[model samples]
Target: MFMKTFGWSFAISAVALIVAFIYGGLEALILCAILGVLEVSLSFDNAVVNARILERMSAFWQKMFLTVGILIAVVGMRVAFPLLIVGVTANLNPVEAIRLAMEKGSIDDPGSYAYLLHEAHPQIAAFGGIFLLMLFLDFMFEERELRWLGLLERPLAFVGRLNGASLVIGLLVLVASATMVRPGKEIDVLISGILGLVTYFLVRGLGDLFDVDNDGDTDADDAGALAKSATRGVGKAVGKAAFMLFLYLEVIDASFSFDGVIGAFAITSDPIIIALGLGLIGAIFVRSLTVYLVREGTLDDYEYLDHGAHWAIGALALILLLTISVEINEIITGLIGVLFIGSAFISSIVRNKRVTAASLPSVDQLSS
Candidate 1:
């Protein structure tokens, strides 16, 4: 079972090693491998959260996730997205940005392509942070029977019943970030954060409005109706629910990639290196992890795992917001996610054992 699930992961690793060896011999190989590990460590929480979404999707959409979705993850995000950032921020053409990326790494000049990306970091962080913060906040604020953090989550859920509660919190956090960051960068951060929040509301609101579920509360299970509700005309040609789910999954993946993209720079300033090392290979592993979890019913078995991922996402969001003024270590970010997920797994096991023990008949009762 393990081999079937993880066989492709091993193949990817072997391919990466060979690629690294061909490119720059042992040094590049080791660095590439480390970068891959770093990406997986920082993104395990992402896989957990993705499993929740993927489980709800149809098998066809799920297959699309592994196929079409992997292409988006590798090419669209790993290669193109970084160039887009550089183009927009530095006023360079997208093609020019690509040329610069392939030139020879950012070695000679302090004002290279890599440096421009660094300059754009605050705005990037604000956008990604706000988007992810909304995801975390929205999840927590929603009423759920099963909660891992009862003390805080219950109150948040109660408050969530109020209209626009998540927006209020997101705005407050952005406002706080504005105060902390330098005056010159403050407006950029604020605008980015606002856009991020709006984007979340726009996407999430549409999905919720047209969401098809087994709960029986919704009746828009019809493709025609769902398309009308979601995008007016966007989903008419495609399976409406499936199309919406595809977009939702992409947005979720983008939010996760923001940190990975920016953090990859910390390892190497070369865009191609970042793309090859941290970007493509890590994405493969994460997508595989999501599939494995969904297929194995890992979330059902480990009840609190989803809650833990949400909490870890919230922590990451807070850190990114704070990073506008403060520099945080990559190692610390990765460790925080690991701690949350690990703790939750253990808690689930302990709870399951207790429940099993309680259900068993005592020897005295049997004797009686």
Candidate 2:
């Protein structure tokens, strides 16, 4: 399964090696390889969340995620998206910005592409952070039988009794971050955060609007509720539902990738190297990871895994919002995610063993 899943990754890596050698040198190839591994490590939570979302989608859309969605991840979000942000923030045209990013690959200099991305970091962080906060918030508030961290999840669900509670929390985070961030960055962070909040609502709104409820239940008073409550209907409508889900997942992917692009700069800032190394190879691996999880029904077996991923996401969101005022290592963020999800996975295995033992017949019954 590993080889089958990551077959393209090998090819992409080989190509990245050649590309790096041609573009920069053997040094660049080494940096590209490290960036790819760093990306996979940093974004494992993304794979978990993606598996959850992908489970709801149709088989065709699942394939699309492996194919078309990956294309978007490598080409659109990870590569072009970073350039677009730099372009907009630097007041350069897209072409000019791409040129600047490709032409400048220095990591130590403050005037480099990576540094310029840092200049835009707060806004990038704000945008991704808010979108991710909404995702994390929704998961926390979602009513499900599975509970990974009951201590926190249960209380959160209790507070979730209030309508718009999650939305309120999201707004509060935005406001708090604005105040807490440095004065020079306060306005930019807030504006970007607000835009991120609006983008979340818009995506959820579109999903609810387009994912038609065939059951004739028109009671969608709470948009947040509708976001998860409205499960996809059957047969022909499945295609539409899956397509909407694809859009939803892509947005989620986009939210998960901002820090990745910037963090890759910490290794090297050659735009093509970043695009091919981190973007392509890492993206293919992630998609494969998502597919593997769903195919194996890992989520069904490990009930609390999604919960852990959400906790990690919540942590990442806070880090992004706080990055404006604090220096956070990408390694720390990745570790948080790894610890949360890894603990949950172990917990799930233990729980499964307990349940299996409880269901087994006693010696007395066997004798009878």
Candidate 3:
């Protein structure tokens, strides 16, 4: 099962390693591998969250996730997205942006592509931070049957009963994060943050809108009409749902990639290496892991994995916002996620053991 899922990722990683060596000999290859590891470490929780959503999707859409989705992750997020940022932030044309990126100038130089990307970090952080925060906030606020940290989660769920609690909290957090930024960048953060909020609502709402089962609390006539339409258009409806989910998944990927893409510049300013390392190696493995989790019922086996992933996301959201004002090492970000996931995994093992022990018959009963 592991090989079936991750074989392609390994193959792609090998090819990317070769390309990296060709690009800049041993130095580039080493840097590329480091960046790949960095991306995977930082986005492990992302794979967990993705698996939760992907499990609901059909097998065809899951393949689309690996195929079409990889193109978007690799090309869109790792390559073109940074170029777009450099272009817009520095007022450079796309060609000029490409040339600037190709030059591989010192990141400290104001004229460098890396410098322009750094200048645009505030807006990028604002958008990505808010988007991820909304994801975390939604998860924290949701009333779930299983609560990993019942003490804290119960209270949050109680608060979640308030209308628009997540949105309100997200707005408050955005405003606070904006205040932490430079005075001039406050408006930029606000606008980007608001747009992030809107984008989440738009995508999530569209998914719900297309979902025939999600049309909550309908009258008999309305239900009958929906049932008839569903019977007639089930395939089309499912396709639409999958497409929307694909879009949602892509957007989530983009949000998660913002930090890794920008931080990859620290390793090397060459965009191609970043693409090869992050897009091909890192993103492929993450997607493969997600599919593996879904297919293997890993989430079901490790009950608290989802909770840990969401908590890690919350931590990442905070880290992204912090990066807007102060620089944070990528290592710190990665370690926090690993800590949450590892702890949850251990807790799950203990819980499973306890359940197994309790279910077994006592010696006296067995003798009888």
Candidate 4:
């Protein structure tokens, strides 16, 4: 099953590596491999989150995610989006942006592709940060049957009983983040953050609006509720609700990728290598992992996996906000996410063992 699921990712990765070798010899190939690994490491938690949502989508939409969705990831976000940002910020035409990126212009120069991208990082970070922050906040605020950090999550969930708690907290965090930005960039961060918040509400609102099942029952009030409520109407899930879920997933993926996209320049400014590494190889593997988890029922078997992923997301959101004023090592960011998910996996195993042990008859009971 694993092979069947990931065979294409491996094949694509191999081809990309070969292309990288041909394009820039051994150095490009190595950088591509490193960036690919980096993307996968940073996005492991993202895969868990995607699996939670993907399980509710129809088989056709699932295929669309792997096909059409990946096309957007590769061509749109990985390639054109970076160019667009560089172009808009640097006041270059599309052709100029493409040429600049291909030339691998001096990152130190203000007019360079890498330089412009770095300049735009504040806005990108703000947008991605708030989007992710809202996601994390919504997850924490929702009522759930299982809790990974009950002590903390329970209290938050209790407060979630209040109306629009996530929105309120998100705004506060956004304001706090905006205040900490460089004095001149405050408005930029504030506007970007508000756009992020609005984007989340729009997509989520669309999902909820179309969440009505065949019998006219609407259950997708929020992100947490969408999972269970969406699955309740699997056959009818292919319409707007499913499309909106797909859009939400794409937005989530894009937010998860902002840091990585900017960070890739630190390794190599060649957009081709970045695309080959992050998009073709990394993104594909992440999607395959999502499918593997869903088909294997891994999330259900490991109950806390979802919780851990959300916690990692929360940590990531905070880290992005922090990065506005403080520089953080990419390695540290990747490790933090791994730490959360790894601990959660261990906890789930221990819980399973305890449950099994309790269900079995004791020696005394057996004798009786």
Candidate 5:
């Protein structure tokens, strides 16, 4: 399994590297490696969460996620998305934007890429932070009742029934906050929030629609019929769970990519380096880490890991929300996640050891 996944990942990475080499040079290669490592470290929690979801998916879905999903992740978000952002924000023609990004060390030059990012920092923080926070809360407070949605649980369910009034109130809060913080940019923030909320609801609903109760007799014929029925039902379920999963993955990826993309402005504005370097390195590491978590069943063995990650995601989101008024460093945000998850990991090990010891028979007593 590792080899198969790794093989595909390696091939993709190789193609990315070749493209970077042809377009840029040795600098691109070095930067890509560094950015890759940074993205991996920051997104380890993401992998853990994604793995939990992947485990619940059917084999066919799993393959799609590995292949097509990866393409969307690495190419769509890291490459195309950033370029689109730059084009829109900078008002540069696509070719010019690409040229500007490819210019060596353009991101690092003062008053260049960094300047543009600095201007956009407030928006990035607001969007990325809130999205992360939502993810965290959904994981922590929500119970994992939907198998099709996998790790996704019902947050609103935890809170009990949400009437139209409640949805209105939630919308009001999002609107009020966005307006108060950045009145001019309220629309952007509101859109981002709505997207996140909608994605969450769709995933939850799809999970409910497709989830098969384990108690049912799952014989070959029964399973086949169930799958066929599910496929049809799934089509009716407005948002495909697989697609929602892809969207969720993209949202989180965008959130995590914010710091690096913004920071790349600090390095060099060259869009090529930003896209190729970060895309190759950060994107690959995240993908590999996700696969690793799926293969290892890390969440099953380390029950608290998910909790820690969710809490961390929640904290990160809160920090982002706070960014509307105050600036927070990405390093600090990342550290918060690490601390929570690390504590949980250590605690789990200790608990496991204690359980093991308690279960073990005392040799002296046995002999006596």
Candidate 6:
């Protein structure tokens, strides 16, 4: 099953390596491999969190995610996104932007690629940080007793019924906060925060609305009705859920890519190198890591892993927000996630041993 899911990953990576060899020569290949490893390591927690949502998706959607989704990630974000950002922000023509990004060793020259990246850093940080903070707060403060908007509870029950309205309110709050606290870049911050919130709520709502209930809750088992609710009588809720899941996945991917995209500026501003190095490496691992999480049932086995990842994501978001006034290293953000995930893994192993030991019969009784 794992092989079936991840077989394409190996093929793709191999192809990428071959292309790198031909186009970029040996140096490019070596750099791509190293960057791939670094991206994979930094993004393991992201893969784990993504797995929780992806595993719940139907097989067809999963395939779409791997194929079409990968194209969007590698081509759209790694290549086009940066260029677009440059064009929009710097008022540079696309051709000139591409030219500036491609001059070999240009990235290291002062006031060249680095200056451009630094200029845009505030906006990138604003978007990534606020979006991540919202996700973190939602996960950390999520009410356990109530599922999906905490409907079982009173205050939350009212809040849950607001459906899409809560998202609007969240946006308003974000806007208000940005305006009050950071007046200089308030507009940029608001735009980033709203985009993140809207994306998350839409995706998560679709997931919740379409989710199948297998735990035997009769009220929750109305799959047909659940599937039908999201569309304005156009499609099944499951379809909507799948679409939402796709959106959710995209947002997550975008958030994960933000640091790498920005950091790639620090490497060599060759758009080709940035695209090939980060895209091939990061894309391959996302697929592999997603499969690993699904196969291992990591979410089910390690109760705290999701929490840890969410916390890490939240911390990253916070760091991004702080970047408005202060710089936060990507390495630090990555290490925080590693530490949290490592602690969760150790805790899971210890818990598993305790459970196994409890289930075992006493040695004296066995001897008798």
TM-score of each: 0.90, 0.90, 0.92, 0.93, 0.73, 0.77
Q: What is the C-alpha RMSD of each candidate to the true structure, in Å?
A: 5.5, 5.4, 5.3, 4.0, 6.5, 7.0
What Cα-based lDDT does every candidate model obtain? 0.81, 0.80, 0.87, 0.88, 0.61, 0.68
Q: Write one digit per residue (lDDT tens) for candidate 5, span 240-274.
A: 54445555555566676666666555555666666
Better of 5 and 6 by lDDT: 6
- State, as a TM-score between 0 and 1, how close model 5 is to the true structure: 0.73
Please give the distance, in angstroms, between residue 160's alpha carbon in candidate 3 and its true position after superposition. Answer: 0.7
- Give the range of the ten consecutive residues with the poorest summed lDDT in model 2: 213-222
Best by TM-score: 4
Tens-place lDDT digits, model 2, residues 1-368: 87877787788778877888787788888888887887888788999999888766555567788889988999998778878878887788888887888776576667666778878888888889999999888878878787878888899988888899878998898888888776788889889998998989888887788763232323233343334434423222245656777888999898888878877777777788788777877877788888888777688788878888889999999888888767788888889889988998999999999999999999999999
Clash count, one per candidate: 0, 0, 0, 0, 12, 1
Q: Tens digit of lDDT per residue, candidate 1, span 118-220?
A: 7788998899899999999889988888888799999999999999898898999999998999879989999999999888888877776666332223233
Highest lDDT: give the candidate number.
4
Model 5: lDDT equals 0.61
Models sorted by lDDT, best on top: 4, 3, 1, 2, 6, 5
Per-residue alpha-carbon lDDT of candidate 6 for residues 1-368, written as tens digits (9 for 90 to 100):
67776777777777777787787899878777666666776687788888877766656667777888888889898888887877777788989878877764454465465467666766776677666766765664444641221222345435545544445555665655575444567777667676767666666666576563221222234455435433322222235566667777878878887887887666556667667778976777787788688667677777667767876786677666666666566778778888878877777777778888999999998999
- The order by descending TM-score is 4, 3, 1, 2, 6, 5
Candidate 5 or 3, higher TM-score: 3
Where does the lowest 10-residue lDDT sum fall in candidate 6? 212-221
